[model samples]
Target chain A: MRILVAMSGGVDSSVVAGLLAEQGHEVVGATLQLYDHGAAAAKRGACCAGQDIHDARDVADRLGIPHYVLDREQVFRREVIGDFADTYARGETPVPCIRCNQTVKFRDLVALARDLGCAALATGHYARRVEGPDGAELHRAADPARDQSYFLAATTRDQLAFARFPLGDMPDKAAVRAVALRLGLAVAEKPDSQDICFVPEGRYDSLVARLRPGAVAAGDVVHADGRVLGAHGGIARYTVGQGRGLGAASWDGQERLYVAGVDAARRRVVVAPRGSLETGTATVGEVNWLIDPPSEPLRCAVKLRAREAPRAATVAWDAAAGLARVALDAPGIVAPGQACVLYDGDRVIGGGFLRAPGSVDRVPAAA
Target chain B: MPVLGLDANATEPLRPEARDAVLRALDQPGNPSSVHAEGRAARRLLEEARAAVATAFGAKPQDIVFTAGGTEANALAVRGLAPGRRVLLGATEHPAVLRAAPATAETIPVLPDGTADLAALEALLGAGGPALVCLMAANNETGVLHPVAEAAALCRRHGALLHVDAVQAAGRVPLALAGADSIALSGHKMGGPKGAGALLLRPGIDLAPLIAGGGQERGRRGGTEPLPAIAGMAAAALAARPEAAIRLAALRDAIEVGVAAAAPEARFPGRAAPRLPNTTSILLPGVAAETQVIALDLAGVRVSAGAACSSGKVAASHVLAAMGLGAEAGAAIRVSLPWNAAEDAPERFVAAWSAMRDRLSRRAA
Candidate 1:
């Protein structure tokens, strides 16, 4: 099979490309120049693509395969980075990685692979694709710590049909690294990229401020009980349930405070006691179903964040509205814009952005 | 790699004349800068090569200033002459020229045919005082030839200087150096060895040196020259026949005509424009140039995308974009027949392209 592998110049993708090439598949490696690497990524100490592009080309050279670096700067800026800034300005945590994969990595790269006569498009993602009775199904990785299924929940059904995640079945990233070392890939010892791809320096505020100017305007930090706590430099700096950085009131030792909500329109960070931060219901919008949506409420486990354990939940999907209301077994700090991915055992059902606290038409939490 | 060399514009297979000259120069080792007898012997060979290179491009030996490669030559011309005059560059000019120009230099737009808009150049020159017009004799990607003589006339009328980047056109066509104030040539592009190029200046046109070190090339360029590469460049230039260019052009025509039926969606950019005889920029609508280049390479054919960047990534061609080739900018690939291109290369390319296109279309469907 002719496979198009998305090589990030990282060990995982390099190893995937090597494995496919070893199988005698005509593998072509492609890396996206997502931003102006030299002018932007390099000076900003961000995980820019300059060195990665070099590494990917080297890997392709070693594998004796043809490689390409596609410039997706415009689309990535408009879709991922621009949306990230907009979401942040709206007082939401945006998953730029998920958006990037959904658009540039899967959608655009899949189109490119198809145009190039590739049978399947391979990636280094840590998620499994199981051939179910119906069609290809997305599943969690065997290694729980490395499971990237949540980030990939929004992968469309047609995309899953064409996508191949080769590193999914591996026990851990160590195993993938070992395979890469055995294959003599130079990126075998490369450390896992810790920060967000674009937010290389971990300064998301600056990026947001630069992209969406005036988003960093000073706002009042108000307690949920209508008490004026203090003032914050920017609403973009705080996420839901974050206790610290609540200004001087957070250190007064009165009580542990956590951000309950953010009203972007009012430019206010609503703080409350840690106890008030829990929410049993997360109204998720923009759900992309991997399996058939259950007509009725389906009891399943759910993952609120990438690193957390799956919690018990009942997901009632609304087809017409393209939203899902997940009723968690216990109250969790379901942050707005954080993915609410439902899982049936190990397979991903679907997921979407957690709605703002009061935006779901006042659906009462199962207290 | 057993790859057929169709990416002549990138760099051609070393000509035997060039190879023999390089080997000969290697055997007689001496730095042309040294004052020893061996140095004098090296200087003689260097001067002979300089004469050969200058004469081939219709310039005096004294006018040629050797550089490391075409890039240095172009940089020397643009950066050297950009002090007093306002610079007006063609939109389709090579990055070597574009990057070297003053940041304030205005761009002269190109026509839809990828030809330099001479009217725009005239308008810019008329509007500015003592402007330097930078245009390429032949575009590296599309191979579209600009009206250099006409441009020179316009520059003269406006009291502006004209610098022609003849790197791609130097050996492929007869360059009329009398038309422009200066010309930049690359050795590797014209079947010469890498690491050698020359900037040809008209008599009495004293420009600043781009590199300042040991005074070489009459203080117009500095640093000790790479003699062997220079010798090879000149040898290749001398060996290149204008008739070979004509033959290659015919072969290019055959390739376009033969592959036309199979690739109905393929477009020839600058097809109606006066393009180089040996080059063709084919735009495959659905497939990317990188994909085509790779697929063809796998099938033992070697070609290149039009705007392959510093990292060898086939990015969208700004040249095509400037010419209004919106989405197709990234889809264009250049297949330039080398000076020694075989007769069957045309058929081979057509077959390879058709097969690749067929497989791609089927896969897409």
Candidate 2:
């Protein structure tokens, strides 16, 4: 079998490519030039090929496989980065990694693999594709610490059928690095990428400011009880349920406050007590179902954010509206634009992006 | 299956005669500037190679200024000559020349068929202070020949200096440089090694040295000349056969016919224009050039599209965009047949290409 491995110049993907080739499969490596790393790093006169691309090419050479760098800058900028900034401007937190996987990584690469006549498109993602009774099913990695099924919740069934994840069954990062060392790959000791890939110096606020200036403009931090607490540099710097950066307004009569909401239209960061930040129901739009859409409400474990544990919830699917109403059994902090992925044990059942709590009230109810 | 090379415009395989000359030159070990007996022998070889290149390109032996490559030759011509003059560049000029020009330099647009808009060039010259007009003899992507002679005549009437980049045109076509002040040539593009190129000047035209070092090449270009590559270039130039290009045209035409028959949507961009004999730009209406290039590479055929950057990714061509290709700008791939292409080259490329087209098109459907 011939497989196209999406090599990111990292240890995990390099091991994936090496393992497949060692098994006598024809492995071709591909790296996406997602953005101008030189410009992102603010370096002057730097060549477009950064250290990551160079490492990817070197690893491909060592494996005796042909490697190609595909230009995806324009599409990535339009789809992932643009959506990220716009979501921030609308006073919502965003999972840019999800957008990247949904569009640039899976959808585009799967089509490219087909065009190149490859049997499957493999990646370094810590997830699994199992043959279920219905068809191909997306599952969590054996190592729960490195499982990335939450970020890959938007992958379509057709794309999942043509995708492979060799790193899913690995024990952990240390084991993957050991495989890299055994294969003599140079990225064996390379540190894992942190934060957002495009953010420089771990300061995502600057990137958001450069993209959406209106989102980062100075605004007032107001209490939910109509009191002007203080002034904030930007609404984008605050997310729902965040406690830090509220200086001077973080405590009133020894009662700690957290970010309750961001009113973009009013340019106000609304802060209140921790109890006020919790929500019982989250309206999630743009729902993607791994299994068939259920006719009635389905009881499952729902995850509201990437790092959070799955909570008990009853998800009601409205097929006509293409939205899922996730009713959490316990009140939890729900942030808009964050993904609400539903899971059944280690299997991903469905997922969607969480809408604002009052969005349903803005629309007339069905008679 | 052996991979067939179809990207000659990017680079050509070294000719055997040129390879021999390079090896022979490498055996010597003296700088041309040294005063020893070995240095005298090196100087003699250098002059002889210069004479060979001068004779082949219709220039005087003293007028050739050796540089590192085509890009250096172009930069020397532009940066050295455009100090007091307003630089005017053709829309389809290479980035080597475009980026070398002053920020205020104006662009002369090209026609829809990929040829330089001579009327627009004349108008820009007529309205000018003394100008340095830069235009390529042949567009690299489409191989469409520009009207260099006519543009040179207009330059003379307007008292402007014309610099023609003949990197892709030198051996493939007869260079029309009657009134042109300077011309640029690359060694590797004409079946020589990679490290040598030259800027040929008219009788008394002198420019500042881009690299100021120990005076060499009459102080026009400084730095120790890469003797082996220069020798190879001169040998390749002297051994070039203009008649072989005619045969290449037939093979190239056969390829277009086969590809068009296999995929009816295939369109040739510069087919109606007077293009180089060995080059063809095929545009498949709905397919991306990147996918096409990669698919063909995997099928034992190597081709290129757009301009490959430092990361080895093909970008959208500014040349095609200037020719008003619009949406089809990213859909075209350049297939330039090399000088030593096999007789069955057309058949092999077409078979691999059509099979790829069928598979990809079916997936699209």
Candidate 3:
């Protein structure tokens, strides 16, 4: 079978190409040159740069398969970087990677695979596709610790049809590393990359400064009661639930204040006690249903952050408004613009964007 | 054991004389910089090789400054040129030249035929003062020859020093360093060992040295020289002849005609323009270069997608991009033959290419 493997120059992608070729399948490795004009040797990892392409090619040569690099710099700038910068400008932190996967990586890659006459497109994502009685269902990987369902919840049913995840069945990272070592791959022991592929050092501030030089304006840091506590360099530097480096003098010392909300228009960071982080409900917009949309309010588990587990919740989809209002059984800090992924146990049902707290009308509970 | 060698662009098999010279140099125990008898012997071999390389390029022995390879030679040329003045380079210049020069340097455009545009270059030089002009003698991808002598003369009239990257042309094409201020050559490109190359610096042209370790290469470049590769490189240069050109050209012509018969729509760049006799850049539309290269490899034939140095990159070639070909650049497959390619090699390549073309055509239909 002919398989088109998407190599991102990361250790996982390198291993994916090696494994596919070793299995005697006609594998064609391709790396997407997402952002060609961007600075190289940046603090961020060189995921889709010239060096990455060289490394991917070296691995392809070692495996005795064909390798190609596709230039998608314009598409990346439009779909990922532009959206990310716009989201930040709107006083919200957006996951550009999720957008890239949904638009460029999967959608564009599927088209490339078809052009190459390959039956399917494969990636190194740590998510599984299970053939259940109903249809193909996306599920968490075997390794619970490294499961990436949060980032992949936005993937649609059609996009999942021609997709394959080789590392899905692997029990842990150690097992994957072991297979790479056994194959004598050059990147067998390469350290797993953590930060955003574009921002390796996690210095989003400098990147933002370079992009929008005068966009970040110094603003007042105010308490929940509207008392001016301190001044911040800019609201873009802060995120919900952040505590350290507040630059505020701790006079009262009652409790370390956490950023509860960002008022972009006023250029202010609203802070409150850590205990005040909890919220009873969240309204999700841009709802995407992996499974059929619930007929009514159904009890399930919802994950708001990457590290956070899916907690018990009641999710109600409003087709008229195109929104999903999720009521958590246990209150947590649900920030606006963050992903609200719904899960029925380990299977990802669907997800949507968390809307601002007071933007939706509350639905009454069951009498 | 028979090895299916596809990495010709990396380094060719060393000539027997070159190998023996390297072995002989390996027996000598003294550094060439040392003033002792053994040192003098090593120095004599090094100077003789330099002289041979100089004579091969129609240059004086003193004009040759030996360096690591083509990359360092290019870096020295680009970085050594006067700063603050505009630097003009051909769009197809190798990364060694491109990276060393500032990204904002003015690029001399290349025509669709893979030849440098003389009008654009003349205009660029005419409009600027104190410019360092760079143009390669032969493009590594399409094997297209640029008018370096013409460009160099134009630079000379404008008081600009021209650096010619003759790495691809050294043994394949006759080189005369009369008009250009400097020229770069790589040993591996001409069946010599790797890690040894030379930069031809015209007399009285002072420039900054990139490496300053020891007072080697007349205090222009520093570091311990790889004497074995140097000896091999000199012997290979001296032994290079034009007879291989005629043979390679005939084989290349046969391959081009056979491939064209098989795939009628395939386009070969520089078919009309001057190019390296042993190289051809064929474009197979709708079929990716990587796919064709692999198919050919499976059939015991080898080709490349653009230069082997930048083969793995998925991005379109900057040379192709500079020519405004855009995504079509991905369709280019470069087949570079060595000077001593076998008589039946072209037939073997044509047979393999026909099979691949049949498969691709059926798939397209």
Candidate 4:
């Protein structure tokens, strides 16, 4: 089979290409030029793509597989980056990685793979795709710490059908490095990219402010009862259940305060006690079901954030309104704009983005 | 299956004559500038190649300045000549010319047929102070031939200097450098090796050197000459015959006609214009150029679309866009026949392309 591997000039994807090539599968490596690396480097005098692209080309040359860099800067800006800033401006913490995976990595690359006469599009994502009786099924990786099923839950059924994840079954990231070492790949020791690919400095607040200035306006941090407690530099910096960075508003005399909700229209960060931030139900919109959309309430485990473990929940689907109401068995912190990924055992049933509590329509942008 | 090589405009396959000349030149080891016996031999070889190139291209031996390649030659001409004159560029010029042009340079538009809009050029030339007008003899992507002779007449009337980039047109066609002040040529684009290119200057044209290193090529360019590549280039130029254009044009037209027959919706940009004999730009209505190039490669045929970036990714063609191709600019792929292309290349290419079209169209629907 001819496979198109999305190489980010990293160890995991490099290992994926090497392993696939070793298995006698014809592999083509493609890296996305997501933004103007030259312009970005000029802004801070930083060298980023000059190394990554060279590394990718080096690895491809060593493996004897042809590699190309796809220029997706325009599409990435419009789809992922713009959506990311817009989500923040609307008082929701954005998962840019998910947006990139959903739009550019999975959707666009899958189409490109077909256009290039490839059997499937493969990547280094630590998520599994199993062949179900009906079709391909998205599942969590064997390594729990590295499982990226939540970030990939939004991949469409057609995309999942043509997607391959060669690194999903690895015992851990160390094992992936071991495979790289075994393959004699130089990228085995390349430090794993921890920050968002575009945010080289890991200062997303500054990036959001630069991209959408209206989202960074001064806002009042207030108590849930409407008593103004303190001022914040921007509402974008606050996420539900975050207790730190409240400064003088860290405590409300008897109890420590946490961000409960953000009111973008009013430019207010609503703070409350930790207990008050927990919610029994989270309304999720833009639902994508790997399995069939259940006509009845489905019992499953729901993860409300990337770092959190899945908790027991019952999800009721509202097909007409395109929303899923996830009722957590125990009240937990449900942050708006974070993914509400529902899992049954190790398989992802469906997922969607959580909406702000008590909001009817789409979350309105800041005034 | 033998891979059909159809991307001549990107870089032509080296001729046997050029390869032999390069081999012979490589055996000699002395700087052309050294004053010893070996140096005298090397200098004799260099001057011989220079004379050959000058005679082949209708220039004087002293007028030819060798540079790294087409890009450097263009930069030397545009930057060297544009100190006191306003720069005017053809809209469809290659990045070599475009990037070297001053930011304030005005663009001359092209007609729908991909030829330079002479009216626009005349108007711009008439509107300006003394200008250095840059135009390409043949567009790299579309192969559209600009009327350099006519444009040169217009430039002369306006007291402007005309520089024609003949990188693609040099070996394949009779160059229209009449009354033009300078011409740029690339070795690789004309069946020679990659490292050598030349800027031909008209007598009395004051050219400031792009590189201020050791005084060479009459102080018009600098650095030690790449003798082997330059020798190969001169040999290739001497081997090229203007009569060969007829044979290549027949093959090019066959590919275009066969492809149009196979895929009726296919549109050939610059088909009506006087284009380079070996180049054809095929535009498929709804398919992307990148996809077409890849699909063709997978099917054992090699073609190119637009300008490939440093990362080897195909970008939308600025040449086709300048000709008002609109969305078709991204959908066009250039099929330029090399000097030694197989007689059956057109059949093989058409077969592969139509099969790809059928598969992609079904998927698109």
Q: Which candidate is the best by lDDT?
A: 2
- Residue B342 lDDT, candidate 4, scale 0-100: 80
lDDT for residue B130 in candidate 3, whole number 0-100: 85
The C-alpha lDDT values of all candidates are 0.86, 0.91, 0.78, 0.89
Q: Lowest-scoring 10 consecutive residues by lDDT in candidate 1 chain B? A: B306-315
Candidate 1: give the clashing pairs.
Answer: none
Distance from true position, residue B191, model 3, in Å?
Answer: 1.5
What digit string (tens of lDDT, one per residue) describes model 1 on residues A1-367?
Answer: 8899999898889999999999999898898888877656547644445888999999999999988787788898999999899887888878888898889999888887876768899999999999999899999988888888998987888999999998899999889989988998889999988778777579778888888865688989988878887999888888898987876758436688888888899999998888889988888887778878789999999988776889999989777666788898999997787777889999998877788856652232211
Task: Give one clash count per candidate, in the order shown.
Answer: 0, 0, 2, 0
In model 3, residue pairs whose N, Cα or C atoms come closer than 3 Å (at least 3 residues apart or on different chains), thus clashing, are A44-A200, A69-B314
For model 4, the superposed segments whose C-alpha errors exceed 4 Å read: A43-50, A360-367
Docking class of 1: acceptable
* lDDT at A271, model 4: 97
Q: Give the higher-DockQ candidate: 1 or 2.
A: 2
Enumerate the candidates' DockQ scores in order. Answer: 0.49, 0.88, 0.19, 0.49
Which has the higher lDDT value, candidate number 1 or candidate number 3? 1
Please report how far candidate 1 places residue A349 from its true position, in Å. Answer: 1.7
Write down the DockQ of candidate 3: 0.19
On residues B222-262, what C-alpha lDDT tens digit does candidate 3 reach at each position? Answer: 98788988888888887777567888788888879988988
Please give the C-alpha DockQ score of model 1. Answer: 0.49
Clashes in model 4: which pairs?
A: none
Off-target runs (Cα >4 Å) in candidate 2 are: A360-367
Q: So what's the TM-score on candidate 1?
A: 0.95
**Which parts of model 1 have CA positions greater than 4 angstroms off?**
A41-49, A251-253, A358-367, B286-291, B359-365
Worst 10 residues of 4 chain A by lDDT: A358-367
CAPRI classification of candidate 2: high
Q: What are the per-residue Cα lDDT tens digits for candidate 2 across A203-271?
A: 988888989998999999899999998988888898899999988889877899999999998889999
